[model samples]
Target chain A: MTRTLLGVVIAAFVVLRVWIWRRRRATGHERVRARWGPFAGDVGLVAGREMRERFRGKVFRVGTLLILAVVAAAIVIPTLNSGKAQPQQVGVVGALSAPLRAIVVASATSAGATVHFVPEPDRAAADRDLRSGRLDLAIVDGRELIVDKPPGPTGTSATAQFVRAVSNDLGVAEAVQAAHLSAAQASALAAARALPLQSLQAATTKGAVHTTSLIGLVLVFVMLSQYNTWILIGVMEEKSSRVIEVLLAAVRPIRLLTGKVVGIGLVAFAQATLIVAFSVALAQGVGSDLLHGTAPVLLASTFAWLVLGYAFYCWVYAAAGSLVERQDQVQSLAFPLSLPIVFGYIMALTAAGSGSASELFKVLAYLPPTAPFAMPVLVGFGTVTWWEFLASAAISIVCTVGMARLATGIYRRAILRTGRRVHLREVFSRAAG
Target chain B: MASLLELVGLRRRFGAITALDDLSFSVPGGQVVGFLGPNGAGKTTTMRAVFGLTDLNAGKVSWNGAAVGPAERRRFGYMPEERGLYPGMLVGEQLEYLGRLHRMSGTDAQIASKMWLERLGVGDRARSKVEALSHGNQQRVQLAAALVHGPELLVLDEPLAGLDPAGIDTIGGVLVEQARSGCCVLFSSHQLDQVEDLCESVTIIDHGRLVVSGRVDDLATTGPRRLVVRVEGDRDASWAGGIAGLMISEVNGGEARLVLDGDVDSDLVLRVAMGAGRVTKFVFERRRLSEVFREALG
Candidate 1:
């Protein structure tokens, strides 16, 4: 009876706690709802239109497919290469003296290596392989054990032992020739214990680093370029179509702009997220190791910088769109506006190649224009401190606000200026007035 | 009728060209006002200024006796001269999108959209994309978008410009219906006959300034009415001119047509026609609005 009473009390307490939690959650949700309020009718209207238009647009559909395919390749190729075995090609440089060849092959077998005896005609090629880190060791002249600089006797011990046995057989044969030893006697001497020699390392770790960084480069570039251009072209199209005019009529220019930045930022994120998830699935399913040694923080930082970069650059593109009245003007305007995107991309590529952030890159990490490129690199190489990242993020946020406000001012003044391209001074002066 | 919209001294300039010079007009509720001008005569500029699609360089626009901001302008529908409509969108769907822009929810917008499509004679075209629709059907969709939210006033720039006879008739009926529903309908057109046929009132501008504005027939006549006489003349054309205030403007097929001075009485034209021959017809031109329009403006 006492145990039953305790269980009942505990059940009641748990229920009470859950009820309080739900109530608080509800009230907190209500507060946020009241705080954020409902968006003006035009914002949703424009976003819906943008969503429909882009979803149906040929450029968007086809471009998305191509990018998805590329992401799939990046993931699957490496996973497939992960299983490739380093051929245990041990090159025997001299005329094989058949028994010596057998010992080298046997040692390679114990080491789980695949042995190759180079023909005398291909001696030069075998030497080149040894230098190039492909061939493990060269059993030269049935005596000399040649390899790339030995790994503190762990490598040469096997090669040294194999060579000494072959030399001992030759010594025994010479003794028999002076006092004439038989082939059986020479064979016994060859079978005895030989000196320690090391074997060369297998090509196990080759191409792993090469493929990983390649994937990173391609992934970072395609994502940044595709989404950033989306911002530029999307804004330009909206402006030229005079859709913004109707949109601004309903909401304040700032709200309208904010909603657009948020909406498309979400869309870019969704695209990146899908590609990442799909590629990860494809890699795991296909058994590829292309992404080996890559930092997870690199993916996280890439997404973070994507958002920051889009926020910082979206206002500029929107402002540029307001400056032009015609479609042709948009093409010319995009190149100049896109220089920062291009420069940042190159800088990020260089950082990836060097595997470290430079001073200029560190400074760029703080600037809103370049942070998208620099932040990802810092995160990848483990070079950035938390405070540095926070500073960069804070700067980007502040700049986004300022740029949005400035853009609103210009768009308000310039969107209606349709007869000619509006000069910056005109938009500024008109705003002031 | 109460004034639905009023523009006071709406002046604007584009570099060296003065697009609107002290332009002003008022559109009262349920009134169909024809805005008439030649090309580059500032008709579109004035309409755009009233719609707030262009910033007023030097004037104010009042809606329902209150100053209109951008928010108020959203409630006012405007059909620009260029006929802006997204081409690839479906006809019914585009109207719904535009309706939502003016604050209708999706389902409500769709309901309104269907009703408008039926009303515009495009019920069969509801599912067709705008680019797939004929140009005339696209125009109907454009009109539907402009009217979907039931705005209190509509500013149409050359709604009749590129229509077939049937299309012109259909749109004319639509404009009249809009006016009858207590919405102020202000549309610009170069078709004088259409202006005379559809508008109760009209404003004509030439060279960036007001030429005349008032009741269409009244504004077309600048002076007192004159008697127009026709007579079958066999003998002397000189005898027709002998009557005071009677001048022969044309003579053909043994018939003489004469314009009388505004002060001349009808009996004098009868007397003058008797001198020409046996007066087969003695009728005065019934102030043909076209003649009056030509006499005053042309």
Candidate 2:
């Protein structure tokens, strides 16, 4: 199943990449026109500069490597531990019956476990072996099962449930033999019919989905904060250094801001793609059940959210950056701006950990700031329909458009006002006045 | 022909402070105009307004008889008062990027950037980071960036500030060459001598208003002409004070400078000095731009 999903993802990526390449070639003349066009050329220039600087910077290289290392560790550790899992060991004493032994072995096999049964001289010897931890459970005189400790009443453990099934099968076989029925009757009595069961609600793959949700939330949180800060610091540096004056001379404020965000957005996207590809490939190679069934879907959702989250927050950060002329001011502003992100992250993380979506989380999924963190988790939990996902994404995009417009205004007004920090209220008032 | 650039009734206010008050000026093609003002006199504000960098409360900046817009502004180059360049970027690459922003093709931008750097005497330092360059070299790179796109109009603010004499001459020569190539050049400076040497015309502002503006020779000629007389003898030329309507502004040793009234003749002042002593020199001179600026401002 994982292999098929992996194949599909790889094929899709290749096809999209080729399609872009072919389109670029087919529209070569249009591309040239775009390069020389008034707005596009200016935007392209700024974006090109940003992309070049970021790709060549030490921070980007080191940060990506660090994240990849973390992802690899997260996948490899669980797989290695699962590979080293030990099977259950049982001990039997005093003429263990053939049917009983057969039932015990069959139950263990059905439970996805192996059992190694050893013969003991007496019940005392079986008890000693079990207590010494050489055996997981002991059967004395082929009648009673004993263990060092009692299994929980819920019987959720595979070993406990397997023992119960073995005991029930033995009881049925003993009753059939005691009835002294004919071969056909004995056989019919021993064969218990399976019970028919029905459930009104469909069962959810809770464990895998919950894990995917948590991973998605973290990725969105980290990518948004990191990249948004990059935009903030990047703009602040440009402004304080007064390089923005030079750039604004050549291009419009809106185009410059757009190019900056687009450039850094592409960098963020590239790093995210690399990390996701690494994770999926690593998970598949290690046969890790961590991202088993929903790996491809979860990854794609997380990436989409990353883009949305960045699009929503980058403008705010960029505008805030223009308001301040110093790095210290950025530090103070970053916390307040990150409040919604932090709030949404914690809530989404809590829901993901508990394997359930809260009502508040469902509401937050529609808000642009929190939706990047919440909607993906809701999707993971199967609580949100595809239409709901689309609605949330559409809402985020619309909000982002509004934010970009507002941010552009603030940035244009405040970027050149250098001296003390420019207040947001002042920017608005200045615009109005 | 229409003025290459014209600011008609430009007005801007920052809060209660009026940065520019009905400031109007024009620069013709192929001419270098000096934008001179005292500190806080709105010279920078006027230049920024020309490039549409500042919001004007009223008025318009017209380029070649049309309202200037981004497209026209893109064809224009500006070096702001507070000079800035990305310190982390390579000098050549930064200029090329800026050229591209001005709508130059990639290859064209690259070639132009390289050529400008070479012309500015920083061609060998193209690969060096901006921060790695000396202050003078960085200023050169800044100029190169402004000119890399071959803009039709160049507006520079304090382009000669903080430069050594040699650096000043180099940049001054570059601006002259730009003007000679038919690019309209307007720059502001506190250094009147440099302005006198480079600018064909000047616009002087004070208190956010134009105090004086005209061709350099025209402005000087419009001011009072002085008759300077230097006698061969060591005797003082106090006799110049006796001449009617010829106010002797200065008389020291054998030399005297007299400001003639409208009805007075400069030759009369010289003849009077020649009679007072054996006159070795006699000249009629227009007031220096610096003197004219001080007189206008005062």
Candidate 3:
């Protein structure tokens, strides 16, 4: 009886707590409305609606998942391949000396490979194994190295590197042995180091640095393309659906448009943050060298440029979106809008791969349309000064403001005038007059 | 003082077309006014101008003798000519969102949304997406969206255009109830009979100019009275020509419909009709609202 009474009390308490919690949750928007005031309240309502719709939308969920899957594949595939190493087959013909065998094993290790010596009954057997692809390399007695193909001057294949290492080390060891050097003299020759390379200018864009910049460029291009197009379609949908008339009656056109872009921009930022976080965590967890030695500044610059790029292009797409009357028109309009982005992306990619920023690339860095791609490459290359970077950002920001104002004006005028496509030239002339 | 929504000399031009030309009207609190006009008569333009959706080339919109701005507009609920709601959004949620946009508190908005939906006969369809509802139900939701915040001034353009009779009655009742609750209601519609039944007063515009503005009864009664008489013998138009203020507007067989201008004596007209022929049927009636609309536009 006492336990039953206790259970009843607990159940009642639980219900009461739930009711209170729900009551608070119900009033949360009221709190936000009070805090945000009237102007922000209107904008916030619009933005909140947009955010909820987009987040619940199937396209966003599926698209985000697809992107993450692709990113995971790109990171994991190479790591999976690198984790397993195949042993190099070395055919031993005739008599093998311990010293020569030790030399061959050391050369294999230096070439980042493992060697397994396979005893050959005769040179003919060794030649057969080589022809059958069973043996990567063959040693004839202890005097010569044999192979199906000779390593080229700049060949970087695993077998080519192994053969070259073996030949070079074997030649040096044989020469040292023939000189009959004492232990100390042989040790001194083994300990000799190559001269350190020095240059008047720093070589910053090399190896992984270049790879990082290329990845950053791809990210910026992708995010700019994806999110800006979202703003475009979103605006177009509101206009085409005739919802803009009802919305414009409640709030100013500028606020509604601002809310839309801001909402979509938040979604973009969230998706981007998730991808970036996932990539970093996955890369680190797998001990992959993909993001190894990536500079924090490079990551920060990439994200900064991403924001700048979005800010500059979102307004343009929004303006274009208001002008178009149909979904089919979106494609024709979007294709021309994407040309500058594609151009900058291609050029930045080329510069990143070559590890050199050309004069044209430098010029493009100053231009807002291409700067998002080119500026990051320059930053990764350590060629652009801080002031120059800030200057480019400033230019982009100023241009964005002007573009936003113009786009807002166009949206206000064209949003309500339906039935036909609005011409940009007409909007511009109207504004001018 | 009763709050009044006043549109004074509103003029707007769309390129070469003048959509609203010196259009002026006033809707006082606690009254439902009908905005009647033909196509391109600037009715929609005038309503759009009130909400600041269209740029006015001249004049201003004032509320209670004060200039109306965004703050004032927020208090005004508007249903555009083209009915629109986010088709994917739930009807209830859309209303709540609109309520919040109009500056209603969250809790207030929720309660009001539920109340309006129930009142609109779509209470059960609150969870349903707008696209899933029938056209009549969607129209109810559109009206609910406009009224969710309990706006002080309600402006609806063609709120009755697409509704069935039952829908028309329900919506018409709700609008009347809103006005009785001291909310100013101004709606545009082409249904003259419904306007006559529902509206307290009407403003009729033609070619962007105000053609008639007065109470429905006054507008209907202040016009020429129609006197119809059917006699045994043929009644020619010559009998009505003898009366100074009476003219035969229509003649069919033995019947003649005369228009009595000003204060023409009905007894003298009855006597004249008796003299022409043995009176069979005789009745004097006020002009219908449709006749007033036609004559006003003309």
Candidate 4:
């Protein structure tokens, strides 16, 4: 009887708490309305609607999952491959002293690799082993090195650097033994350092930075295209469905458009943040050096450019969306609209792949359409300064403002003129008249 | 005195075509006004202009004696002829969202949405997606969205275009109720019969110009009255055509309808019919608003 009474009391307490919570929520809504006035309130309402719709949409959920899978693959694949990397195997012909083997091992260790040296009777046996995949490299009489492929001048591969270092050390040891130098002299000779390289021009090539830039470029491309298309298709759907008419009745055209862009933009940014956070956390967990050197700056720049790129394209796509009344028309319109984006992406990818920006790419970096791609690549290459990035971003922003105004005008005029797809010329003519 | 809603000298041009030419009209508070016109007669354009959707070359739309702007428009509910709601959105949630857009608090919007859904007879379908509802049900949801905010003024373009008889009656009742509660209602429709039943007043336009506008009774009464007479004896009434001021508009089965000249009296037609034979039925009646519209357009 006492337990039953306690249960009843608890249930009543729970009901009371729920009632209080609902009341608080109701008052909170009222407070928002009172604080923001009708214009902001309407904008917020429209934005809230967009956000809610997107959150509940299957397309958004599926697209986010797909992109995240791609991102995970991009980050995890290389780390897994590197974790399973094989040690470099060297086959030595003729006599190889213990000192020489020690030097090779030390060089390999310094270059962040493992080496296994196998002795052979002669050059023929060493060459046979190297050709038959029993060895990665063959050293003949401790003087000549043979490999399947020659290293580039940049010495980008750790194995190539290790081989060079080992060969140099062997040469010094041979000369010292030939001179019959005292132990102290030999020690001093071994302690000598190689000359530092001073170049007349700045070095533009960095393996890690180049890879990060390429990845960043691809990320920016995928995200800008995806989110901008969302804005486009979303606007088209709303316009075709005549929801814009209902929305326009409550808020001004500009406010409605602004709310839509902002709402979708926030969704895109949130997804990007999730992907980045996941990539960072995963990279840390796997102890990958893929994101080494200026990684934070690269990430920040990539995000900034993603925003600028999206801002520049979203308005254009939305305005185009307003001109059409059918889903099929969206496809016809999207191709033309996406031309610049695709072009910019390809150009940036080329520059990133070649590890240097072309003069034309440098020029494109200042233009809003291509800057979102080119500028970030330049930043990663260490070819652009902070002010230069700022200048390019400012230019893009100014252009975006102009585009936004023009797009708003187009949207307001064309969104209501349904039935047939409206011509751009017609919209302009109507505006002028 | 300033009217509840007023449009004065509204002139709008699109390229070489003028959609509205010096169009002017007003709706008094607590009255339902019908906007009638032939196709491409600028009814939709004028309605769009009221919501400031169309740019005017020269004109003004004022509400409550103040220039209509976004603020005033926010309080004004509008249903465009192309009835649209997000297909993926649930009916009740969509209504509440629209209510919020019109500045209703969330809780108020929720209650109003529920009340309208129930009132519109779609209470159980509130959680259903709009596209999942039948066309008639979708129409009801559309109306609910418009009324969810309890708008001060309602403008609906072609509100009953594709509705069945029952749907039409339901919408008419709701609109009448709204007007009775002091919400000025303006609706456009091609259905003249529905308009006659619902509207207290009407404005008809053709070629972007106002053809006729006034109280339904007044507009019907302004035109010449017709006289109908039937004789008990089997006789033709075609002779009534020969009357100096009476033009026989129709003659069939001993009954004749005479269209009297402006100065002619219906008593003369009745006397003429009485001389021909024992008069069985004589009645004087004003034209219907539909006939008035046709004649005005002609």
In model 1, the Cα lDDT at residue A228 comes to 57
TM-score of 2: 0.81
In CAPRI terms, model 4 is classed as acceptable
Top candidate (lDDT): 3
For every candidate in turn, the CA RMSD to the true structure comes to: 11.5, 6.5, 7.3, 8.1
Name the runs in model 1 displaced over 4 angstroms: A1-40, A86-220, A227-263, A283-294, A325-327, A417-433, B1-3, B207-209, B220-222, B226-228, B232-261, B273-298
TM-score of predicted chain A against the true chain A, for each candidate: 0.63, 0.75, 0.80, 0.73
Question: What would the per-residue lDDT of candidate 1 be over residues A231-327, giving only the tens digit for each residue?
Answer: 5666555566554544443455665666566666666665665565555555556766544564455655676777777777878877777788666
The sequence of per-residue lDDT tens digits that candidate 2 reaches over residues A188-290 is 7657577987868544446656666666677788888899999999999898888887788778899999999998998898778767767777777888776
Please say which candidate is ahead in lDDT: 1 or 3: 3
Model 1 lDDT at residue A364: 83
The stretch of ten residues in a row with the least summed lDDT in candidate 1 chain A is: A28-37
Candidate 3 clashing pairs, residues 3+ apart or interchain: none
Evaluate model 3: give its lDDT: 0.83
DockQ score for model 4: 0.41
TM for every model, in the order presented, reads 0.74, 0.81, 0.85, 0.82
**Cα lDDT for residue A4, model 1?**
48
* lDDT of model number 1: 0.67
> What is candidate 2's lDDT per residue for B1-298, written digit by digit as tens?
5248988998888888888899888899888999998999999888888777788999899999999988998898889888788889878778877888888877787788878888888888877899999989988888888899999999999999899998898999999998888999999999998999999999999989999989998887885777778877745567776878877667777677767788887777767776777888788888788887888899
State residue A245's C-alpha deviation in candidate 2, in Å.
Answer: 2.2
Task: Please give, for residues B48-80, the per-residue lDDT of candidate 3 as tens digits.
Answer: 888888778899999999998888888888898
Looking at model 2 chain A, which ten-residue stretch has the lowest summed lDDT? A27-36
Q: Provide the DockQ value for model 1.
A: 0.18
